[model samples]
Target: MSEKSTVPGQFTLVLHSHLPWLAHHGRWPVGEEWLYQSWAATYLPVAKVLRNLAAEGRSHLLSLGITPVLAAQLDDPHCLSGMHHWLGNWKLRADEASMAGNTALGAHEHRLATEALDDFETRWRHGSSPVWRELIDAEAIELLGGPLAHPFQPLLDERLRTYQLHEGLADAQHRVGHTPAGIWAPECGFTPGMEKNYDAAGISHFMCDGPALRGDTSLGRPVWDSDTVVFGRDLHVSYRVWSPKSGYPGQPYYRDFHHYDHASGLKPARVTGKTVAGPDKAPYDPELAAAAIERDVADFVATVRERLFSESERIGRPALVVAAFDTELFGHWWHEGPQWLDQVLRALPEAGVTVGTLADARDRGYVGERVELADSSWGSGKDWRVWAGDQVADLVDLNTDIVRLALDTLDKMRADQDGLRDPVADQLLRETILTISSDWAFMVSKDSAAGYARDRAHEHAHAVREIASAISGGQLAKAQRLAAGWAAADGLFPALDARRLGPALGGNDESGGGSLRNHAGPRGRRMDAEGPR
Candidate 1:
């Protein structure tokens, strides 16, 4: 009747783009450097690729998850100027390498740095929100928003978790001009009944790991009486290209992320081999890596087609195969990733497999039956061990105490004075959310940046405790001073107001009308730093 829709099944590619608030934290090895590196290497390049495809009339190609915290950084004027400076310095570093006789390496890096600078100055001159809005408006990609500061919602206090989820989506609406219908739950972490929270927040769908669905991730499933659907990552298809033991990026020809030339502060060597030492590794070659990308693209397309075809037959319906990954895995971690992505997206459609966003898949009837998802995450052992296990016990204890103190302080303040604009309380809440971020625990467990992570966690916790004490002691002047200082340092969410925490403190109203303040949800609009901007 309608040509029978020859598409066997739908394949959705989800890339999670996130980074902690890094501006003014530190430079060099960790803090701001991490943000700039990913911004240039991953964010910009991926945006370019998506824009190019959109120019070719590709719509709803994939789902892009951008954390609220990362969005704040992108939109901040401070970070914009800092990122511009970083690019200029990046080109200088490459020139220095060339002067030292590493011309080939320097030339490659210099070209990249130059192009990134030009792109930033041209398209990103205003802010990243406008750039992303263009893509969203074009229907070229579906955007996924997460909680403010990327807190691990399952481990958080229910009240705090709700506050974060609502505020996060609100912030995204503020920036991107449209509330996201879906979210990429931080770390794919979830607990039963969390779907109810998603429902209340106006979220239509979200994602989790395969184990959360008992390994049946062939289709998006409605959970717990909520029409809000949950999609799980299909590891069988995803791991075909990138796994711990082996991945296309780990191949000898791709640029090595770890090994860096000390003088130029740039990575110049290819991965070479698993056991190869940095000093002994071979120089990176662009031509060889380009060839590898094509081969991997072909293999990956075949893998997705086969997985979808087999699952469609077994399940007796059109299935959906979602392969999710960290957005940084492309240009940041895997130097050749963006190019490979470009190839795969183009190849899949030609290979007779449908490529579309998760929303598109659902609209085309790829949803399965309702399910009861277990408490799970996409971490080690397919459980919550990474964020809440014995390895991070101290940090876990700190998060509990910090969230409690901040909520208690805010509730007490509201009891005394209703509808007072308290910057001190607002900043305290900001510090509390930063401390509860899931990154600290994950870093500690993995030992990747344990020291920096632990320090950051404690730093925010200390700030929260100090500001709360100043408020509780009736030292309003002292509290304001302390808050002003912390706001100068860890200030990311400018639209966050202390009154937004009312619902989390046992207030009945979703809109803050019957509560201490009169702030509406992000969808309906909310108060800004200067009041209703």
Candidate 2:
């Protein structure tokens, strides 16, 4: 981390990279499309930036969180072949565009598609393990992990949460060759005693929203009474680049993510105006976008410099300013985001603003006093509303019902079979995990692909119900076929075992400490597993 002897403070850029399991699921409008688009647009370019900077002798560039489920897809055999085909199709589309006389769009897309294909072939064809492993080995970025499937821990059963987190950490270890001491806690959703869980799991630091600190995000705080540090995002700085109302991506020069040239499957328009119809938008110009990237990079560097100086003065010492964003927001949503990132990272060091990862900020003692964190998330209201709000009340009930039923069936079978390896129970557990994912509730609440989200949740729940029934009815052959079919579709974590979800390990009785199974509350909701316990 480069710094002036009397610098204002350390600045950390945290990018949370995550997506739900989308392997053998649908493709065109929702499932694998999301994965492949992000892989090509965001992952490839951002990784290239990090690798280039590492070659330039840069280390501790930023902190990146890749959830284990997304990691699984990035390394899955099915997804790799699918992505290869996607890239090939991208180039073919560009060729078609050229034949159709949109020469400029065709030329630009051809270059991008060819580069992406080469990068994928050379580095990513095998799997994402080597690609990320190289960066991890070089110390270019600190990798922060999260629970498998990105479950909303605050709403999960204690035993399930513990299993998910530990397994999530182990999965990352399996991929990158080291267990992460830090995590981007799913949804930033935290309960009070969850810090103790982090401590038990050996997680040293985690992140939360700015409001979790009551707006005091100048430094990382020790949560309650644990050494597990909680870093709250400096939303004032983060929102300056990408927020609900305004951000750099809204600039007229950037390529518009919404508008598409349907025939070629390429984005050919700039964000000419906020309310501009797709047909009215101007043609995207790479040169103009490059100029915008430079302008935004300068603005961001200046923002950090000003925030650091002002925060240092107010706090009476050098303070920490963390700007965290969804990694997908970069190249996927904002076409020039990778370029902007490259510039801002290099420019910050030159501007006398110290840049470092979350680990650097913590190890170098950019920490503050201990404070008790309340129920919070980086969601709509900085609370549990997004995942546990009224709009998702049905999902909450469905999750509760399936969890209890699956646990009951598994518990019965495990005791009867003396802890035998039951693939049916393993598939049962897998479906439940998939069913309870936070993405389903989030998408429904935000009205972004709500239909697909709801269908996925119900589909998994139905799987659990039918498999458990098959077992209880003594239909062993039918159960085997069902579990095998589901595993063929929802197959990501190869090491997940049904036997490992042994009791709560350590948690309140409501979440599997004892025999308190029927946890359905008013309107069939699960009351006990929520955050404020």
Candidate 3:
């Protein structure tokens, strides 16, 4: 028998890698800075850990979902070059910090910056496609695909949603040369009957927040009599590492993410205490951190071990425990995240725990009783409030208006042109996707960079309004010019076609023969924008 058959239960870690399209949009504080910082502090180290493990003959290590938008940016010429410059600038900042008499901060940053720059120069200089593709070929990970711009599916009209799903998978296939049978549905957002959509897209499994399962998150369940399985984030096991009040990252010895040495743009302090003010936090000590990481890893391994045995006995069978988190959390938010990741993976298997991706759980017969799932997301309050709340009511309404307008206009323009794809229509679709991204509304509801989120939403909306009006008024030349201008920034997924939003794509819509424009749903209309400032 395989190790999987002998183990008590299976644990799958799902790390969602996503960021809204940030290239050529903004740089400092929110835009490309978010990308570069995460790239330096998170992506580099995390990829290194995985690569190291794969070299050690580890297969089926974990499930990683790289959003189509983020994947595009990772491989984009502009982002690749920008990331190089950012890495160099980081080294310069470290030098400046040292020259200004902060020896510890400068030395630490210099080492980190040098390593990151070397990683980029050697492996990432060409772009991240080859990096991800290498892992995919190694079979060390199960790649989960997602929508092009990470829209909340429950809020999208069937026409656009179907199109977005297809195009997003296509983009992923183009990037990594593998079309995933699974998806990390943006925000784990789900509505009833979405299985048909997944089925049509050739997806075998997808994710959801734990509450969506209501009980027994130890197995993947087929939703509503469909073969498409749904795996839920086992929050009880997941929150142990990053929970607000008691996660491992909160321990005082870990590095503080919020306390930065402004002089050199480096974080120089440890999280001396959770409630302790930033200025009073103790200086970071690597020795303390090494001790903390070892303890955390062992504790996490024990936690999973306990949960697995408890769940299997409770359910009367071997169980499946899925711990899902944002990929950025490991390094960007929790500075020692990459180290913890490497150690945890090694520890779990050594503890006689079975480790595998969600796909392994499915194939190994970790299926449970089929049940109807309810609408849910891994958002604030565990519901749609964060994206559809009263605070973002305007965004919701605007999203509805713009989605309907963009689709209808594209449809009309296609009809006039004998069903050919129009450049103007494509750009309108791109802006619409960006405008309705869940990030914007999320930032607004959380009051983190609400203004930037609002501005991006309006900017895309303005572009949509402009392109749509131009087309409607028969100003094809002006509309073409505007599309070209917008493409300079909003261009991603060049293969994106406005003509693909067909009702005939087949997703169990009663109105399959009719346009998939009936977007009337439970909450307010749908919309999105970006930022935390």
Candidate 4:
């Protein structure tokens, strides 16, 4: 018998980039500081990696999901101004270190900080608003859009979910000049009926975890109830680079994430070894870490090549090995992550393995059969416990009650008024949507920044409760007063209109599902009117 010919293999690398709506929110354990840090460490560095590869005539495929909320923040004038100031401050700090430190250390610090600042200024001169446009112009990346402000979809009231999804897509298109073909599903939180809404939005595909795939994972394929394809991340391939417990980043030579210098509040240590405690970790050295990155890149390439070859031979078709990760992980968590990415993208093609985007894989006919996906997330243990854990049970209850009350209030107001002319009611509606953001509850549950998270959740909840009470008791003046106070603090999504949610709040249609359709008009009016109240 003649030996069978094996099919070629393929893989996609997807990175999801997001930060909460924090343009006005300032620096702290959780706020705009997080945004600046990720920008300096991950976004800018990742952009350089992609740009370099593209310049070299290498086609390295990667999918990047930039949430609409994040896009807004990136494009915000205030954020752009703040980022410029922040970059200049970084350089100043480096100069200070150089003046106080050993000459070699000083020189290295100043050089890196100066180079980073120069790159940030050159690449983002169009201000924060045009970063997405620049990336699209280069065609070095594929953009993945998501619901406005990253709400947990399954738990949201259907009307609000529809409004968020619809408005988010519109916002992305307005900003990026193209309707997105895929969504990141806000924390990879997917429900049974979401695909129908996705199909209505003209999205061709979305991503979920590997376990969401039917049978054994091989390639992305369409899900049932809609024609939009779902690509499942191959956890086996991804975890090799960065897992919770083990990954290349956790190696002895890599920079330690936890052992930061108390005075500077900057990480200043290397892992040294698995047994090394936080206090005892060795000081970080960029030169040593660079060497480690080289070794890890080689190892990663070997693993991908082996998996692709073996799987192709077994299946007699092209095999995909997706490696999905959070964009924050690159330089924020693992200081060497950006360098490792640069090395891996440069080396993968030489290993005879293809590097391609999710869209490319789909276009080349790599997708397989469709299946009904389960409710899933990429959180702790691949479950929703992180968002709905015991620590946040009360928060979940509070949010649920407030959302129902807001929806009921909205219904009553719409029924009572001739049109959506009530500014008081409009403010109430905006507060309601802000209160319903899944981010607050998630932060509370994770204890990542528990105090701020609890405060924000309660703040929005109080606004909703008070507004509903005032409206119900016929205290229109008091309701208006309270709306003004809350608006001053949380004035985002100002264009939110309660009228567009309509009567079918939680109802789903027989096929796919009912979504809030855009009302025809100027873009701003449509966005404001169609978004969730």
Model number with the top TM-score: 2
List per-prediction Cα lDDT, in the order shown.
0.86, 0.89, 0.86, 0.73
Give me the runs in candidate 3 sitting further than 4 Å from their true place. Answer: 1-7, 503-533
Per-residue lDDT tens digits of candidate 2, residues 120-205? 99999989989899998999999999898899887787778888999999999999997998999988988788999999999999
Residue 51 of model 4 has an lDDT of 75
Model 1 lDDT tens row, 168-258:
9999899989899999999988777799999999888899988789879999999879988999999898898778888788988899999
Q: What digit string (tens of lDDT, one per residue) describes model 3 on residues 197-315?
A: 99989999999989888856999999997889999999888999977678988899999999988777898899998789999999988889999999989888888888998999999
lDDT of 4 by residue, 483-521 (tens): 887766555555556666657433343211322122112
Candidate 1 Cα outliers beyond 4 Å, as residue runs: 1-7, 503-533
Residue pairs with colliding backbones in model 1 are none
Q: Give the TM-score of candidate 2.
A: 0.95
- TM-score per candidate: 0.93, 0.95, 0.94, 0.87
Off by over 4 Å in 2: 1-5, 504-533
Better of 2 and 3 by TM-score: 2
TM-score of predicted model 3? 0.94
Collision count of model 2: 0
**Model 1 lDDT-worst window of ten:** 512-521
